[model samples]
Target: MQRLLDGIVKFRRDDFENHRDLFKSLKSEQKPHTLFITCSDSRVDPNLITKTLPGELFIIRNIANLVPPYRETPEYVSTTSAIEYAVLSLGVENIIVCGHSHCGGCAACLGPAERLNNMPHTKRWMELAIPVRDRILKEIAKDDIEARRWMMEQANVVEQLKHLMGYPYIYEKTISGQLMLSGWYYIIETGEVFIYDKNLGEFRLANG
Candidate 1:
């Protein structure tokens, strides 16, 4: 808390001054290129990882970075509505569904023991992850726990991307080639990022 407080003071004194022009430009308008949907993990800073500027990436961080299947139940949730606006109104060209290694939410989908069922809302939030379980189970041979966990992390990203397509605006844009969807996994330990290749059905490192 003390460090964050001091950092804010320093930003006001020095850091904000360094990027004054950038902030000034952003004050007028914002035209971000992508809708970056990622997990609300303390260690995962999207801008820091991508080296993007203030007006570059329009981000949505949530528990597990989960995209719930498009629903028209007459009740509005901010997450779903935000996704609609980012696609239809903002005209974002790319949508990135990023998941990371060691995701607690993804792992919880595997069992009741790990999931804190007492936390009803948290469990409900993780219900978005249910589809990924079947994929991981099908892919992992020998019933290996370690193998299942790793595959589940990557599969969760792909599953969320699939759910993104359930949104009408996003689906139409993607079909017409006006929008592109990317599934990505970030390995925090190695500082490595892997983009899922739909063609090869595997994740590969971004090449230099």
Candidate 2:
């Protein structure tokens, strides 16, 4: 699109010029400290939210920000393999599973199956969040649309964090204090971020 092209030109002229030294250092190799996993939603910009620079966050994004529980398969698993590379190969210190409000993927998971009849691949991918859907159904009233949506988004983040622990390497690193795990819920419209607290067992405002 023309917009993307114009943005690229402007970036090369302004942003790239300003960060020339940073880009040159990253030309050879990158040593990012965090593995940021989130949705493919255009609104959820990991770098913008975290205020991280290039080579600071290794990002892996997909629908609903779901992480498939670790399993060996001859078939290529995109999300699983990326996590492996970030953790074992790149040695990222932290992994954050972020989910945002009003996510189409999360909404689809909570909706009727026929709604996704045409999107077979996406429907299959959403199976990873079935537990999240189930929990929302059980705990929240069907008439409370806002409650259901908010719960689905936050619970999905926690669910993916659980899936991340299924990775043996990630688990070992976490146990040894080499890696940290976090679940985040971002409010797109409000610019608010909530972090899951293990002690309180609920998401709390990150700023406060």
Candidate 3:
């Protein structure tokens, strides 16, 4: 708590002050170019990783960085709404669904059946992992927990990207070339980022 407060003080005194003009313009309005979605993992800092400024990347972070397929349910879901707005309203050109190494949520998804029994809501939510689970089971089934876990993490990103496209507005935008979607995997320890390259059939290092 103290560290965060001190950091806030430093930002107020140094960082914000040094960029007063940028902040002043942001005060009036914001027009971000991309919508970055990633895990709510503490170590993953979207702004820091992307080296983007305050009003550059609109972001959404969740437990597994999951984006549910487009639906109009009785309940209100904030993440879906954010995606809709980011695409149709903000006209954000790029949407990046990022998964990461050593994700607890991914590990849990790949683990025992008992894991989900305790948290029914989580169990239900993670049904979205079904496609990912099946893909991993068929292609790269491994006894090593760590290896299987990370494979599921990467596969989950691809699954979520498809879910994002399931959104009608997102699909239309993508088809018309008004929007571009990307899947990224961030490795925490090495500070290496791999971007899903559709043509290469591999995760390639992001150059810029």
* Top lDDT prediction, candidate number: 2
Best-to-worst TM-score order = 2, 3, 1
Better of 1 and 2 by lDDT: 2
Q: Please give, for residues 4-105, the per-residue lDDT of candidate 3 as tens digits.
A: 999999999999999999999999777999999999999999999989989999999988899998889988898999998888788899999999999978
Q: Which ranges in model 1 have alpha carbons more than 4 Å from their true place?
A: 141-143
Candidate 2, poorest ten consecutive residues by summed lDDT = 155-164
lDDT (0-100) at residue 85 of candidate 3? 84
lDDT string for model 1 (62-169, tens) is: 888899898887886878988888888788999998889888777777766445668888887887787788777787874598788878888888888888988888
Off by over 4 Å in 2: none
Flag clash pairs in model 3. Answer: none
- Per-candidate TM equals 0.93, 0.98, 0.94
The numbered model that scores best in TM-score is 2
Residue 177 shift from truth in candidate 1, angstroms: 2.1
Checking candidate 2 for backbone clashes, the offending pairs are: none
Q: How accurate is candidate 1 locally (lDDT)?
A: 0.86
* Each candidate structure's count of clashing pairs: 0, 0, 0
lDDT against the true structure, each candidate: 0.86, 0.94, 0.89
Model 2 Cα lDDT, one tens digit per residue, 15-89: 999999999999999999999999999999999998989999999999999999999999989999999999999
**How much is 20 displaced in model 3, in angstroms?**
0.7
